[model samples]
Target chain A: MITKFRGLVVAGAVALALSQPVMAENVEVDPWEGFNRAMFNFNDGLDTYALKPVTKGYKAVMPDMAEEGVHNFFENLADIGTLINNLLQGKFENAGKDFARVSFNSTFGLAGFIDVASPMGIEKHEEDFGQTFGYWGASSGPYVVLPFFGPTTVRDGIGMYPDTLVDPVYHLDDTGARNALYLTRVIDTRAQLLASEKLISGDKYTFIRDAYLQKREFDIADGDVENYDESNF
Target chain B: MLNIIEGEMLMKKSLIALAVAGALTAPMVAQADATLYGSFRVALMSADDQDLDLRDESTRIGIKGDVDLGLEGTKGLFHWEGQLETTDSDAYDAGTGTFAARLAYLGATGDWGTALAGRQYHPHYLWVNIPTDIFNTATSDAGEWAQLGNNQHKRQDNTLAYLTPVMGGFQAALGLVIAGSGDDADDDVDGYNVAAKYSANGLYLAASYGDVDAIDRETWGVAATYDIDALKLVARYEEQENAGVEDEATEVGAIYNFGEGLSAKLRYSNLELNGNDGDQWAAEVEQKLGKGRVYVGYFDYDSDAEALAAKYVDRLAIGYRVDF
Candidate 1:
C-alpha cells in the first residue's frame, strides 16, 4: 500500500510537470511604402488645432508650474519610449515625440485635467513600439503611414486593434462620440509633443518618417542601432 | 508548488478521514461532532520538440476541510478548507516545503455569520475568476490583477476574515492581512488591509483597500458579477499607488456552463501603470473536459506615454488536467 501510494503520488507529480505549456508571442509589421502623407497631415492639423488651445489655457492658468511639470512628465515618460526606440533602432529616434507622449498621457490620464503632470506630482515616461516589439520578439517589417493613425508597421498595425479596443473612446457605442473622443485624445496627446517641433530642423514629415523607421528597425534588432542611416532625411 | 500540494494533500486526507468517521457515527450519537475534508489533483502534458523543454506547471493536488463544533439553535459552528499544489511550479509549490494553498483556515457558522482565521484568499479573488476568459494551463491572473503593491492582493498569510451570514440574498465579508513595511529598520509588520464583498444569487460585487505603513502603497478595487442563463459574466477594477507610482487594472470575463460537467471561458485584463501611465492587456480562454481541462492565452502592453509601454505575449497549448 505504501509503495502504491508513492507510485500514485509520483505519477501525479510527473503528470503535473508535463502539463505546463509555453507559447510564442511575436508580431511583425511590414512598412507601408507609399501614399497617405495627406492623411497624416490632416490628423496632425486637427491635433495641432485642439492642443494649441489647451496648451494656451494651461499656460494662462498656472504657467510656471505647468511648464515645469509638463517638462518633467515628458522627460519621465520618455524613459520607456527611449527604451522602445533603442530596442527598435540602435540610436533612439523621435526622441522628442517619445518624450512628449509620456508627458501628455501623465497629465491628462492621472492628474484628471491635464495639469500637464504637475498637480499629480508625477513624472512622464518614454516607451516606443520598437522596445515593445523587442520585448515580444516581434519583427518590424516595412513602415507604413496609416490614414488617420499616422506612422506604423504591419505588426504595429495589427497591434493597433487591441490598443484601440482597450481605449476608453473605442468602447463607446456612438460612432460620432467615439470619433470625437478619439480625436480629443489624439489632440491632447499631440499637444504635449509641440516642444519637439523646434528640435527638428529639416523636412518635418520625412524626418519623422525616417526616424520612425529607424526606431522600428532598432526594435526588430533589440536596440542594435548600428545598421541604419542617420543623415539622409 | 509541490511542497504546498503535499501539505495540502496531507491536510485533506486527514480532514476527509475525520469527516467520514463523524458521518458514520452521526445517527447513533446524541452529542455534536466535528469533521474535516479536502481534495487532490494531478495532470500530464507533452510536446514534440526536444528543444522546447516545456513543463506543465499547473498540475497539482490538494486537500481541505473543517472540524465541526456541535451546538444548538444555529449557534455551534465549524468549517475549514484549502487548495494546495504538489509540484515545483513557479507559484504555490516551489518544492523544498514551500506551499501555496489558497485557503487554510478554520471558520464557524452561526447567528454572527462566519469568522475565519489563518491564511486565506482575499475577497478580490472572486473578481480574478471572472477575467479568465480563456482557460489555459498557465495563468497570469495573480501577477496581473491580485497584488496591491509590487505584491499581489490574492492569497495572503496571517489574515483574519469575517463573513456575515447570508441575509436577503446578500452576503458580505471583511479581511485583515499582515503586510511588511519596506523600511529596513522596522520589522516586517507593514500594516493591514480591509476588504468587503457582497453576493446575491449569481450577482456578486466587492471592494477592498490596503495600506502599507511607511510607503504610500495603497489600493482600492471594485468588482461585479452577473450571469446570463448558463453564462456567467464578470468585471473588475483595481487602483493602487506606491508613493509616486500609481497602477490601475481592469478586467472583463465570461464563463459558459454547458452543463453535464463541461464549460468554456474567456477573460481579458488591462493594467495601467501611472507613474508613467502605461498600460498592459491580456486575453485568454479555456474548455472543460471530464476530469481535465484545455486552454490558451494572449497578452499585450503598450503606451503612447513615455512611462507606459506595450508588449505582447501569446500562448497556445492543450493538456489534460484532473483533480481527485
Candidate 2:
C-alpha cells in the first residue's frame, strides 16, 4: 500500500506538470478581478488612514532630510524596478528609462515625486511574478492574499523569487528600516493609485476589477500594440 | 538476496524520479538554451603553523531549463543542483556525514513575471557571488552568508520567489523564504532578498538587499568592463553589513587575450572587515594553457601582522584549474 501511494504521488506531480501546457493554452478572463478590486480599496484605506499621516509625522520631525531620503529611496528603488523589467523583456535601452524617471520625478514631480507618470509621459506598468508565470503559460492557480504582499496567485507567488532578486531594496542591510521602507513603498504605491478613483464610475469593485485586468493585459504585452489581443483578454 | 533486491528497487525508483523531473523542466528555457547553472564548493584544510597548506576546493554542479507552456505562452522551469563534498558524497566514510549545498526546485512564468519554489539561491548573496575571489576562495569563502544572525534562512527550504517582467531595461524580484520551523520564536524567522541589475554593452551595475529575520544585510556594487580587441579592464566595489558590523570590499582587475587558447589576467581585491580596522588584500593573475588555466594568487592581511605571519598565512600560491 505504501509503495502504491508513493507511486501515486510521483505520478500526480508528473501529470500536473504535463497538464500545465494545455491549461495555459486555454486563456480565460479571471473573475477574481472583483476580489482584487476589494484589495485596491483596502490598500487605499491604509494609505489614507496610515501612510499619509505617518509621512506627515515624519516630515514634521525632519522634513527636509526625510523628504530627501524618501525621494532618493524611491528613485533608487524605481531604478531597480526598471532594470529588472528590462532584463526580463530583453530590452537594454528601455532600462535606461528609469534614470529619466528618477531625474524628472525628483526635479519636476515636486519632492513627492508625485505621480510623475503623467508629466514625465512614462506609462505606469504593473507586473509581478504571476504575470510572468502567465507569459510562460503557467496556470494562474487560485488567488491568494499574502499576509503583506496583498493580492497574488500561486503562479505569481512563485514568481516573487526573481522579482526581489532584482530589487535593490531587498538587499539592504538594515532590517527594521528595510521592512519599514518596503511596507512604505507598497503603501505609497497604493496611495498614488487612490487618485484613479476619480476616473472610475459605478461600483468601486467593478471599476477596479476592469482596471486591473486591463492593466495586466497592457503589462503582459510590454506595451506593444501589436501584441495586444483585446478579444482574448 | 532480499536486501540486495530492496536496494536495487530503491535505486530504480530514484532514477525514475530524476528522469520525470528532467522532462518537466526541459521546456522552460528550451528556447535560449539559457540554462540555470551554478556550482557549489566545500573543502577541509589543515593549515600548518609554518607552511599554511590548504585543502582542495570541493565542488558541485547544477543545470536548469525552461519551457514555454502553450497556455498564453506561460513557461515552466526546473533546476537541479547539489554540492559534492566528503560528508554528502556517496563515498562517505563510516564516521560522520552531513548535507551542505544542494538546491532543487520547479516554477512557472507568465505575464506578471516568474515564480519559483523549493530550495534555491537567496537574494542576500546574489551580487556577492558575481565578482572577484570572495565567494570561491578556499580561505574565507562566501559561506559566511548563513552566519548572519536574524530570521533569514539564507539558502532556505520551502521557498517561493517572484520576478517581474523586464520593462525598458529595468526589472525587480522579491522572495518570501518560509521558515518551516513551527516554534513561535522562529515564526518571524522568514528570510527575504531582492536585487536589480542593469547591463548594457560593457557596463553592468546592480544593488541588492537581503533580510533574514530581523537582521538586514545588503550588497550594493557597481562593476564596469570594456573590451577593446584582445584587452579588457574590470573594476568592482561591494559593501556588506551583518549584525551592525560593516565591511567594505573592492576589486580591480584586467585581462588580455593572446590568441589561440591563450589569455592572461591580473586583479587586486581589498576587504576591510567590520572596522576591526584591519584590511586584507588579494592579488591574482591567470594564464590560459590549452584546455586548462594556470593561476597565481597572493593574500595579505595588513592588521594582525605578527600573528598572521606566524601562521604562514600571508603568501602567494600557483595552481591550475580546468572546467569540463
Candidate 3:
C-alpha cells in the first residue's frame, strides 16, 4: 500500500513537472485556485475543530520552561537538514556556521535549550530541499495546498519527500519515541503560532499565500531581495 | 573518428554507472512497501489472594507488506506475526521467553475483491466478536464469551478465505478450514465460516456463523456498535452448540474519549454454559502517550457453577503498552 501510494505521488509530481512551462513569469501562479481553496477550507476546519483544542489544552498544562526546551530541541534537530541543504546549494560558509551552531547547542547549550550559538554571533540558516531545488533552477510551479501539511508549490511539495528522508527525527529507531517527539513538536509549533493569529487580517487564505510565496522567494535568493525587479509587483 | 569513439566509450561508462545507482536506490524505495511493527505489553496483576505477578499480555511483532503485481489494481499481500514472551511463565504452552507464531498469511487484493490462504483470523471473530473486545488485556474481554464451547472462534490454521469488495457500506467474507493440527487435527476441510458487515455514519453492524466439523460445534454471533462524538457503545450476542450442549453469551461495552489522549472503557458480559450461569464485568482507564498507553483495569467474575467459579477470579491489573 505504501509503495503504491508513493508511486502514485511520484508519478503525479512528474506529470505536473512536465506539463508546466520552464521558468514561466511569476504571474497567475495559483492556476488551481479552486482546488486550493477547497483544500484550504478542509484544513482550516480540521485545525479549528480538532487540533486547535488539543493544542490549547497542551499549552495550558505544560510549563513554560519545558515548552521552550521542547521547541529548542526540535529546532536544533532541524539544523541537520539546514546544514545539508546549505551544502547542496553550495553555501559552504553558511553550512559551516550551521555545523557550529548544532555542535555548540547540542553540547554547551544543553541540547539547544539555550541559544548560546546565537549570542556567539553564529548565524542560523533556514534551508531545505525546496530552496536547494530552487537554487538549482527548478520552477516553483503552481501553488498547492496539501492535506494536513498545508501550503506548498508543486516543486516544494516534491521536495518534502527528500526532506523527510533526511530528517533526524524521522530516522529514530524507536517508533513510540519518534511519534512522541513528532506530537510534541506539532503542539509546540501550534502553541507558538497561537499568538500570531491576531496578526492576520482580511482574507486569511490570500494573506497566508502571499506571505508564503514571498518567503520562499526570499529564501531561494538567500535574502537578496534586491534581485527582484520592482515592476514585477 | 577517434573523438567520436572516445565519446561513445564515455557514454557507455556513464550508462553503467547510472544502472548501478538505480540498483542501489531501488531497494531503499521498495523498503517503504513493507512495514515492521510490534507491540510490547507488560502488566502487573493481583488476582484474589495471589501474589503480585508480572505478565506478558500478548506482546507481539509482525511484518506486513503489499507487492504490486504489475497489473492494474492488483497486489499481493503477506503478513507474519509472532508472539514474544517476556515473563518467566509457560503462558503460551511454548515455555518461558519463547517465540510463537500468532498469524502467518498470504493473500491477494484487487478491485474485484480479496482472497487469502494460510493461518489467519476467523471471520467470525473479526466481524462479530471484535466490536465489544475493547479491553487491552488478553485474559479479560469479550473474547472469553466467543471462546465458550468453541476453541476455533478466534483463529485457525490452513484456512482459505474470500472477501467481497465493499459496496455501499457493506461487505461479506467466506472462510474454509482446509486442515488443522492438535485440537483441530482434521485431515480434510473441517470448518467453514461466513461473515457480513455494514458500516456507515459512525455505526457498524455485523454477523457471522462458523461450523466446525472436527469439534461437532456450530457457533454464530452478531455485534453492533454506534459512535456519538467521543462516546462509543457496543453490544454482542453469541451462541454455540456442541454434542447436545448449548452455550450462550451476551456482552455490552462502552468507551468514552475525554480528549487529550484520555479514555475510559467499561464492559459487562453474561454467560450460560450447559445451563450454568456466570457474569463478568471489567472497567479500564487509559492514557495514550504517543504510540503507547498506560492503563489500569479491574474486573470480577462470578459463577453459579463450582467449576466456573474455580476458573474465573477477580483481579486488578495495571499495564503499559507501546506499539510501533
Per model, the share of native interface contacts recovered reads 0.00, 0.00, 0.00
The order by descending lDDT is 3, 2, 1
Q: Candidate 1 — number of clashing residue pairs?
A: 84
Assess every candidate by TM-score: 0.43, 0.42, 0.52
DockQ, candidate 3, vs. native dimer: 0.01
Q: Which lDDT tens digits does candidate 1 get at residues B15-79? A: 99999999988766734444433333332322222132234444433444444556643443333
Candidate 3 lDDT by residue in tens digits, B1-324: 999999999999999999999999999987759989999998877677678788888899999999988889999999998888877556557463455677899999998999999888888988887666788777633225334423556778889999999999999999998875434553568889999999999999999988877768888888999999988999988898876798888889898775556666778888787888778887776657789876667787764522454646777777779999
Ranking by TM-score: 3, 1, 2
Ranking of models by DockQ: 3, 1, 2
Which is the winner by lDDT between candidate 1 and candidate 3?
3
Q: How much lDDT does candidate 1 score?
A: 0.52
lDDT of 3 at B19: 100
